[model samples]
Target: MVRLADVAFAVLFVGVVVRAAVTDLLVPASTLAGIALVVAVVGFSLFDPDGGDHAASLVVHVALVGATALALVLVLTDLTLVSRAVDLALFYLVVLALVGYRRAPLSSTISLFPYLGAFAVVVGLFLLHSLDVSPGSGLAAFPVFATLLLGVCLFVVPRYVEADFLLRFVGALSAVIVLVGLPSLFVGSYSLPFFSVSPWSNATLSPWFVGELPVLRSIFPNPNTLGLLVFPAVLGGVVDLHRTYGRSGSVSLFMVVPGVFLAINAVGLYLTNSRASYLAAAVGLALYAAVVVIDRRAVPVLFAGLAVAAPLVGFGVFRGVVPIDPSNRFALWGASVEALLAGPTLLGAGVVNTSELIAPFLSEGLSGQSSHSSYLSIALRIGLVGGVAYCLLVIGPLIHGAWRFKRVDVGMFALAAGFAVHQLFEGYTLFQYGPGSILAALVVGYVIASVVPEAT
Candidate 1:
């Protein structure tokens, strides 16, 4: 029965990816099929009274149910674009559920400090953003909160499951992402109107043009949406390389696949002209390389130098340098800081509509949509207090994990460091929908599991 469920889960995953890939061509079919598959999987687990008993497993089930509830609410509320929200919530829940059931922790589940702390910070930011603004801005707080919660869940589940099981699932997910993304490279166009190429044929528009390469949001809706999946694959590949190398063969091949992914993603960002992703990817790679060097002192600086240079080379090949536009980003940051200093009440720009509060003060060209900076976005929506707390909540565990496992567990440490840096540019802590959120969750889970000596 478990094996049958696994098969169904895989089918559901593929269906989800397919729906995203051919959203334009098969909206009704993809939507119905994907939604049905998710319902089936959830139903199967809930009805199976014998479905394992473990804290991690329980967490997975609860998370999935919570996500499903959120999706239903969004759809009922007429948020059509929120289909991706359903996809993301379901995917993480499934991952955690599978990992948890397979492992069934031998000891009590480790402390929830990592998850709790992250949640507190997110809440604080939401409150801070509420000060001058209405309380509605707090609604925007969900994505970041969900992202951090999911990360905590992922990191903890692997402690009970066999490493091979986790790797297999991750590998399968990676393959599906690649399959979904490949079609976008050739077929149809996906555009974000806010950042679309002007005076160009709509046929030429694609997320790859804007630097959202790998998962191919153009095939679906948003490029950053796809990044939710791709980011985790990158981390999974890193973990796989570590595991595989411990057994045998040249680690070089393992490194190449992730390298290619990084290259492709970097190019996508350049094409999209998303400076934030480009900056995030550049910083992420640098940090990952730094972690690698710190672990394997024998690796020559030449190899390290090449890793650093590869993205620049790829950028030149794919998209020539575009003019930099920091005006809006800087303005948002400045305005958010000023708003926070105005007072200490915690009412945020009401719920989901922060734009109304921002429009009056924004520059001519800047849209009040979102402050490009995740930090500023949180401040504007939640407030300075919430923003600061959120930062600590997100980073504290990674810091704790790094300190606890630095000497003995290299893989987890590297992941924590890589993610920590990635957050600097991309709002991994802010959005719950895509690969970034899942990756953050996985990293947190992995860190918790790795640091717990008994579990390791």
Candidate 2:
């Protein structure tokens, strides 16, 4: 009964995500169903007679549920800051759920303190800034909050989610994204998460692919966001492909299925024509080969493919295939760095303040978009101390557990490496609050969990 209830809740959560995306893109929905499901999960989590006897959880459950209920009311009432408050409520529920996840004692957490503590300092600075400068800018804490979610999943997942659960979740998510998005590319487009690229209410986003060029986004707002969302799944598919072949040139179900899945995933990515994503995939695969089992046969072919793909992508970028010019990237980066230099050296600039600093350098008065690089974005938002702390919070665990990279741990390492590389130029997986980064955070934690423990 516990397993059934948990699966139901997960399924409903995924459904809510899909519906919410569609609602945001096309027609607006009340979103009351999403709230109803959240409420239902709370009930199932606490009072199911056949569920596991978590006798000590009653108080925590009640408090979280009460807070969520209150947030739901506020969302309906159209309170401005209530959405962030609701997010906070949801975050608390996730923490309580992870912490209370059966015989997993506090001791399982000893190895996590340094990383968490470092992140805590970053969060402390952000919270202080959020309070001091833009107190109403509750949404500004997204990057740190996303990082926190990833940390919790990383520390608690090995104790809770097993191999089968992870595989199914990743597989299902990839399929849904690919299948649903493939059709939209050819037929029409919808509203994006940030804003529309097309003048029409239901047209493809800016520089959207046409004919041979797909420019697909699936459920996300743009092709770039879609690329990040599918990256981990692609990595997993590659790992499985390597795992399937044998020394005797043997063929197995494992090799065939994963190869097919990856081919499909690659098609989805290729159609997007996102250069950063292409490079991100290569970075991930390289780290995977270095740490985990290396398929001597796959490396050369993969390299050859990357060689061909990279130059083509670069040519496209040089030719102005994208709406944003290559030169503007440098301009944006320079402005961001200057703002960081001008802001507080130690404690750093306030959350969302970097946008204000950069607006003078941009047209149309753009503000609050990430500085294209997570590293720069953090340095721009917080001080050097916070920046260092944020880096340690995200990458420190992998460095500390470097020795643990083996077998499946390679996949996690590869995923982390891809995300690391991508953040150098694009920062969604590292810094964002949209639907694209939502799943990416869980991927971060799951990968961290896989690599952090000796035999996990």
Candidate 3:
């Protein structure tokens, strides 16, 4: 019955992808796919005796459904796009949590160190800041806060699910992402024409845009959001590579796939030209290399060395590297710090609209305001205490996960470490409107679950 439901879901998903490819209905198609997935999940849950145990794995599932229902109510009543998107994202997270729960073991459930700590801090800080802020601002901040909170919950819940099932599910999902999800991004109305330069078009275009391929922006509203999703998969591939090679024999095959994935992602990141993402990817790779060094793994060291070298080669090829533009980042950071130091009031400037908060301070030449830095953005809206607490909340899980990895599971350790590095530069997980934060939460939950022993 579960297999039948999976098949049905797959068929529906394929239909949505085909429609998205041929029409301008990408958003609607994605929405339909999401809805279909929800129905499939419900059907499967209702029919399967194991569903109860699976449901118990993901506590956040209820919260996600409630959030989605609320968002739907607001949307039917004509709520803002941001509101709708937040709710939709919540729904997606819930679905993912359910999937995780269904596949994982109950004994594996237990809150790991850093993530739990991080959640506590974020909640405490946000509440304190809420006291000082306007009701609207507080409300706006709620989605972002909820995303983080739910994510933390998802990250830990996998521990309760079966490990073998959890790993198989992740592996299969990764395959689908590469095969279907990625291909879908490059074809149809959802297709990024920027990537496909036909001979005729190429001949006519200026050299600047000529060689560049459109990176995978997915269904994300922007490239930055796309980067957030892709980054983790890239790291996961690297982790897989490390594990595969450790098994002995078939070393060449183990080395090849990960190397190719790394190269593809690096090129993708460059094409997106997201400075933050570039920084995050670089940091993530560096951390991975550090782990390799600690593990004394020769192949990884060689890979890391090559990774370090690729940028130099690219710099030479591109010539004239983009100038460092830290001025705006610095200014924003300064303002955020100043705001925090000014007072200890809770309930920050009430869910401050990102744009409104930064409009006054931005230079005329600055293309857009709104704190580009997630940490600063949260701090400005929630206050210093909340901001710091939020940071702690995120960092705590990774730290604990990493420690556990050192003792028990290496693959999960790598994942947590890689994500921790990725978050430093990008703000996707901190945002209110996409899969970035939720995915991060899910990955963290998986890591914690994988590493910790089942509770007695």
- How displaced is residue 203 in candidate 3, in Å? 19
Model 1, stretches more than 4 Å misplaced?
1-111, 120-218, 249-275, 291-327, 342-350, 407-409, 427-431, 453-456
Better of 1 and 2 by lDDT: 2
- Per-residue CA lDDT of model 3 for 1-456, tens digit only, reads 234444443344334333333343433423443444354344444343333454553334555555545543443344655654554454444434433333325544434444444554554444444334443443534543354335433542343333323333334443433343344333433333422211111112122644434444444335565456455556656666665676764577646755665556544445444555565555555656676667624324433454466457435534536565543555555555555555434545645565566555556675355565666666766666666666664555555544454443444444544555555444444434234554455555665555555433
Tens digit per residue, CA lDDT, model 1, 195-293: 221221222334534543333443435555455455445555555655666666666675565456544543344434334454544444554556555
- How do all models score by TM-score? 0.57, 0.66, 0.58
Model 3 is weakest, by summed lDDT over 10 consecutive residues, at: 197-206
lDDT of 2 by residue, 1-456 (tens): 235434543553354355434544332222323333343445435452223445545454555445545543443344645355544444444444433333334555455566556655665566456544332333443333443334334443333444344444555566567766766555565454642222112323344334443466666556676676566667767666665563325777646656666777877766666667877887777766754454433433443454466457656866778454563555567777777777677777766645676776665644555477777777777778888987775566445435343423555555665665576676543434343444444456555555433321
By summed lDDT, the worst window of 10 consecutive residues in model 2 runs over 195-204
Choose 1 or 3, whichever is better by lDDT: 3
Candidate 2: segments with Cα more than 4 A from true spot? 1-20, 23-109, 133-152, 184-211, 241-259, 290-327, 361-370, 406-408, 429-431, 451-456
What lDDT score is found at residue 246 in candidate 1? Answer: 60
lDDT of each: 0.46, 0.54, 0.47
Is 1 or 2 the stronger prediction by TM-score? 2
